[model samples]
Target: MNAEPEGLTGTIAIQVESDVVTSRQMVRKLTRQLMFSLVDQTKMITAASELSRNTLVYGGGGEMRWEIIERDSKWGLRLAFEDHGPGIPDVQLALTDGWTSGKGMGMGLSGSRRLVNEFELRTAVGEGTCVTITRWKS
Candidate 1:
């Protein structure tokens, strides 16, 4: 999360609300470029929006890094939301549906994970957090 993951295609700072919207747009463009279906595009965009918002609100502003990757002749989009704010203390509690630390709808993290093909969360108390998600193009 510190050295900027290899093969980063782009990055968007999550400092303001507009940045979240921008992140969604970027993800949409990549999804379309990868020829993902309409439903898959929506899922990736929604997950990007939620995670980007979390990077802003919960992480107190961060950056969303993206990459286009390939595996076994299949293409995929990988996104990482990294932040340096106070890290999450309870990963399980945070991932539980209907559990929220603030006024959110309590589905950001869990829902985002459900929308993606792969989800990874790394956090350290007093350090920071990084959430990486990937969706393969079928």
Candidate 2:
């Protein structure tokens, strides 16, 4: 898969796991290449970790696509996570913190949304879910 505004791009496939600790580690490794400030990279890594866990737990399995983009002299990173499991029936409800379908903390979606500069999510009952997040250089 291709992420727009391309600079550096990569993809990772993850399986259903309890903690998704490996996925979070991978995000941190990839984010390091972005050359972001320490604080910014930390936030991006945190968001990516949270979303990866969500996909693994809720969607059964999924993949994350990462890319660095440059637009109008601005640089940023973009992530697209896709999964093919029982989809979310109500996006709004799912986005609400503390609202979970499983034994999750329910902050995955909302917290991730807040951590990035741009966020978009698409989900359906059986169609699956796709979440895109972007963090730009300040």
Candidate 3:
């Protein structure tokens, strides 16, 4: 598992509908524990909900793994979602606002990127896709 050696929080499978709900709950709880404000908590939960859904609906299901990390004397939560479905054909266009591969608002990637301090997406045709995002607490 991709990890933050010091502060592993937990990991959840993004294989079904329930997983998305569970992921949001997990992110909310973790964000709160890290002393994140309600607004930040909402943003984190929303991002997790969207990404977990994308993992299920678009990526044919995968996993969401999270960990706590410390950088520059500040703590943060890191989440990673992975899937083995058909990879995104055009990541650049995908990041564009309103671009939808499915029925989504196409906000999953771009919106989530905005909600976090760090965002990274990796994909390849016929290979798979993985997204990692981190939200920091000041």
Highest TM-score: give the candidate number: 1
Tens digits of lDDT, candidate 2, 56-113: 8888888888877888887788888889988999899999988988888889999999
**Residue 90's lDDT in candidate 2:** 88
> lDDT for model 2, on a 0 to 1 scale?
0.81
Once model 1 is optimally superposed onto the true structure by TM-score, how far is the C-alpha of residue 119 displaced, in angstroms?
0.3
Residue 34, candidate 2: alpha-carbon lDDT: 57
Candidates in descending TM-score order:
1, 3, 2
Q: After superposition, how far is residue 130 of candidate 3 from its true place, in Å?
A: 0.6
- Winner on lDDT between 1 and 3 is 1
Q: TM-score for all predictions?
A: 0.93, 0.87, 0.92
Tell me the RMSD of model 3 versus the true structure.
3.9
lDDT tens digits, residues 1-138, model 3? 232232566679988899899998888778877888888888889889989999999899999999888888988899999999998999999899899998889899999999888999999989889999999885
Residue-level lDDT of model 1, residues 39-115, one tens digit each, is 99999999999999999999999999999988999899999999999999999999999999999999999999999
